[model samples]
Target chain A: MTEGEFKIIFTGPMGAGKTTAITALSDQECVSTDVVNTDLEQCDKALTTAALDYGHIDIPGASGVRLYGTPGQERFRFMWPILASNAAGVIVLLNGQHPDLDEHLSTFVDAFWEGGRMPMVIGVGRLSDDDFFTIDAITEALVERNINPPVLSVDVRRKDDVLLLVEALLCQIEVNELGLAEA
Target chain B: MKQQRLGFVGLGDDTASACLSMLKIMDGRSGISWSLSDPDAADVLMVANESTDETRRWEHTSKPRIVVYHHNEPKPSASHVLQHPFRVMQLLSVLEDVASLLAPTQSQTPLKTDLPPSSIQAGAEAADVGEFWDSLHELLYGDFPAAAHWYVAQSDEGELWLDARSRRFMADPLLLKRMMHHNIRPGVLRACNAPATEGAVACSLFAMSWMITPHLPAGLSSWISADSAFQLLRWPSFGSLAKSRSDLTLCALLTKKALTRDQVLSLSQAAEDDTDRFINACAMSGLMRYDKADLQTLPGVSAEAAGSRFGGLIKGLRSRLGLSA
Candidate 1:
């Protein structure tokens, strides 16, 4: 990674829409390795990402943003550290409608935070009006686990929403990088 | 463009006249036009505060009756109900409901012109657009488990796959560009994940847009947790959308307190998936508000009273069907 370039990774459970968010924000063609989903019992979707998703966005005067998405299944856990290496930040997306939403949040947050706390943001999707897991509740759960990050409600399908996550992550990275330079 | 006749029986003169006035206002707003006179010829009957005897007599005649009552009174037996002090939106919703029942085979017919005429183009083009959305609604909400599977796949795969159900592909090879346009690419990709042919990708993309574009309200992508509490922003008018009995019961329960989806389902006979869809639709339409409060703990209802209420509701439903309890 060059001085002007930074890498951001997206990680979440099988149906959290991380790949969709990367596709929404990527400036160029996205590379994906989705295969026929044989794991229908665990996730009701027709397909699943077999490998990593890759895309890039140009940052003015900066080297640019390289976006990577990790496969959501646990079988691909080995790839998480590989994708997170040299990454400036991680964005965690969770499916709000999932029955075990809190568990999903805890699992992903722990995985990403293991490499020493990187600038991270959480985006939750597919919420209904009567949903029990609100932003505040999620934030509290994170606080209880001693991992505090900016949590947001997002729809990966919307470009602006995806961009908002990117912008928040970049801002956090800049603050941390600047603080290190001053020290 | 079918004319339907509606009549009110057993309603007080004041209530009947008030209802008639509201119907007149809704005459052209809804797809169906209405006539107030001639109860004998009415395709649907509105029975408000009618005695059990009168309701029984009307029930035997085979006309679908909408029973109206106050909150304090015991609910009557009928497929539909309208509360006192009606709103125009509620009345329009009921009329639309009856129209759908009367013509279940006319799936392509536009239920209501939700958009104003000036905004919608006239003639064949307008009808085509209406029919397209109607089909999409059926595809998404109707009994096709394949559509649900596609939705789950899209949410999982993001932009990597295409839906086999879509009928057109974007002219541009840049799938992301097309995806950015409609924001449903993830689901599209998932639906087409196992497509037998490459052409299925394009077809599924086309179908995906048809299904998603018209329905995407701005800023509606947030996830709803199964345990969250909710408040109703507006009264759900009966027969407005194709709601099941469980959907109606859930809506009614929402009027009382901010209840979790699980709590609501536990109290009613609604299936888990249908309750989820109903809650999503309500949230998207701005008919509900998410409450931050945890689920409220209430005193247990005495078994005796609970059984009586349950029995009465069931009996009313049975009586409406002209079946003896």
Candidate 2:
């Protein structure tokens, strides 16, 4: 029997729009494990996805895909690998306004990078025209680790934008499978 | 699990059952994973020893084969085989051997200078923009003292001011679009000491360089030396730029490891000009490094992950979303 169901992960620091991205693509409303914010130092949001975000897309004729978003807090680090295991790929979203933009990028990239075995695409939200070039730093950082995946500027509110990340993830997987049919 | 398709030919239903059972028994422990498939679609074939018809039917195929022999029958292939009543380790051993054969392409292989490079296939004829663009390219990619701070590109339509240090430039969006669409009249770019100090579309240095690629001449780009091996320093954003299929494949391959121009041609399903254009885009965008550094990309999918479930799943997801792979 085919393992028809697949998982794609959306993860990043708090308020990076994991839920918003999922909601953009999900067939139904995303199920979130929300908690009143206690850690205001990390983010100023009223609520946070403390456990995970769950959503699904119904494939036309096959068992669909499951989308999981890891909690943004470092306290939930243990869940990252568990969620990543057997995932098709990951989308690491980042808050471009955050002061520690580089740090969050480094942390999530290091955490889920999994030695580059995991295919990842990064989407940075709210990238202003003045700071458009900072995206290069994110791209270079991945290169420093000897990994280069697509780093796109995105707005999670746009369904097309979120889908671009998904499409890129699929491209990443197909590229990895390039020699499959070769003799 | 490293998945590859295993097909059976002329095995009795009982023997097929035994093989599948043994495969399941070895699951998690078997370094190479197998899913049952028809012989036509299989990556490697396991045939019954006495099945001459089946063996003859597959003789012409380049797909690797392993003969299943009874303890008494003579082996056809010297290396790959299956003893009757498959043992878990024995099946694992044969699969691992086949996996090794299908691997090594993805592993680290030093660049070879001996291999013959195909002649550059002619693409579109050189446009009038080559002279003007090439000079700007020289200044952009080359090291110069006056250009130490920056340079402003002067053209008939508008001025584009660029800062090499910041990877940013300022130009009118309509002018940039006209350039990208190849609608701008052919003209030379003149250097002005003072950068544009007025209203215009602020853009990444990559955007203008990438946008101007189509208007540039097509062939092996001079920037990527034919003799030296190179790889990407970073991937350019697929954002805001047109991405061809060739672009994606080249990005996927070069991002993993350094390759000579021909090496890239041999490995990718891209045309010579498309390859040149893709590399040129990377170079002008400051995403390509000339000298090859020791780069290692893991063989994420071993020996036809296309034959595996995960590979199928990825394609399926793309298909479901109405996106072509």
Candidate 3:
């Protein structure tokens, strides 16, 4: 990875609002691959990101900072590592209300875990105060895998929440750099 | 006695007026007299939940701060807190201790903004901390498991009903919150026969155990077996608990691989005592388990290489994005 060229990847399961989160950060409209949805059982959203979503933040002195959102379905699993490579970090967003949240958490977290080399932040959205899948409960699913990234309760509809995930990912990056330095 | 100047910050008008009235009522007291002043001018501060700005400004200062919150419980941080309409005696007791804390001293640290309320110290908490944890240890891990399945942790705030088998508890959210947000402990645990009652919030023992770490009596010393490796079994939900940013960072590092105490200390670059405290919190919370796996020989990237390469970029991103810790 070039010194100033670091991209942050935003990947999650279906209906987790990756495109919206990317759009929230990207100075321009987030470019996405939206197609008519046939997999209603997987996610009931009318449009699904079929390929990948693309966005960028203009960072000075470097090849711009790119934001990539990988397709949520298993078929596009190939895109995850492609986007993850040379990336500074990844943000794993999940629909807290999804019945398959535990599996989604395990699958995405396992894919991007990186043994802590790359920073990851987990944002669970659409959870109400009374939702059964509280942030702590979601964190427990990762416990079985022994991966301990920051798990935050967030709503991607708000730009601040998206920024929070970005901030958290930065914190993680700072920590990783610090850890590597100390090592 | 020198009158201590107290200040209020981010308080509701009604709450501020009530505090002034309460101060007037205590005018005749012989202990350290307090005079309310602007937060910046006061020797101590009575802060509402908007403690971030004030705390960041005074992070290195030796002033005592009591977070005073009304309505719902404030965010679960702050070492010293007093709920609104606090009883006169409670206020007096807290004032007396805080006054002692403000008295000239080097060995003691004033109430740290980062510590949990349970770890709150006013001058001399070390004396009671051992006894506190000893009773708690006996309650949770006593030799006789069959002796009691339920235990009640009674403190100045309220009781937490514990199921010893599950290492979980049920407690009034308000009451438990006071123990967490106010400068108080869950007190010691005593065996009880009744099950956790209907209304209290059910929580993992880690939720309870992690709060006592900053005040443990032996914090300056090491608890780790020099040669043994440490790895986190799970990350305590910091979002659900009282913790500082460093706590999150440490948890992230440990969950990645088993590291020796020295390695952790070196990597974290935290003071020995601080490192010990984090390890203690993880161990006490049962989040860290004995893992003897020597460092999984991940290619040793010199810490310098990684730091130097990404340092400026991170700084630029944080600055350009206006992100602050």
**What C-alpha lDDT do the candidate models reach, one value each?**
0.56, 0.69, 0.67
Better of 1 and 2 by lDDT: 2
Off by over 4 Å in 2: A60-62, A129-131, A178-183, B1-127, B141-150, B164-168, B177-182, B185-187, B223-230, B244-246, B260-268, B290-308
Task: Output the worst ten-in-a-row residue range by lDDT, candidate 3 chain B.
Answer: B106-115
Candidate 1 retains true contacts at a fraction of 0.00
The recovered share of true contacts, given per candidate in order, is 0.00, 0.30, 0.22
Scored by lDDT, the top model is: 2
- Model 1 stretches with alpha carbons more than 4 Å out: A60-62, A129-133, A180-183, B1-325
Q: Give chain B TM-scores in order.
A: 0.36, 0.50, 0.52
Ranking by DockQ: 2, 3, 1
Write one digit per residue (lDDT tens) for candidate 2, span A26-102: 88899999999888876888999988999998876568889999999999999998888888789999976555666
lDDT of 1 by residue, B1-325 (tens): 4788888878876567667755643444445678876778898888876567666678667777788787678866667888775544456556766776887654443233223222222232222322333333333333442332121122321333322132223222244334434443232121222322222222223223423433444322245555567655433322111223454445445533466665556654567666665665565334567756463453222223242312332333224323322
State how far residue B287 of model 2 sits from its true place (Å): 2.0
Ranking by TM-score: 2, 3, 1
- Across B1-325, the per-residue lDDT of candidate 2 in tens digits comes to 5788988988877678767765654454334668899999999888777857877798667888888888777656746888775544456557756876887442224322221111111122222456545555655554431233344555667666664434466677777766666645333333333353444555766676677666667765665677656677667865556676567667767776677776677666578878887777778767776664322322233332234456556666666666655
Estimate TM-scores for all models.
0.37, 0.65, 0.63
Candidate 3: residue pairs that collide? A180-B303, A181-B303
Q: Write the per-residue lDDT of candidate 1 for residues A5-107, one digit (tens) a residue.
A: 5678999999789889888777788899999998875578887887899988665445566889999998899999999988878999987555456667878
Between candidates 2 and 3, the one scoring higher on TM-score is: 2
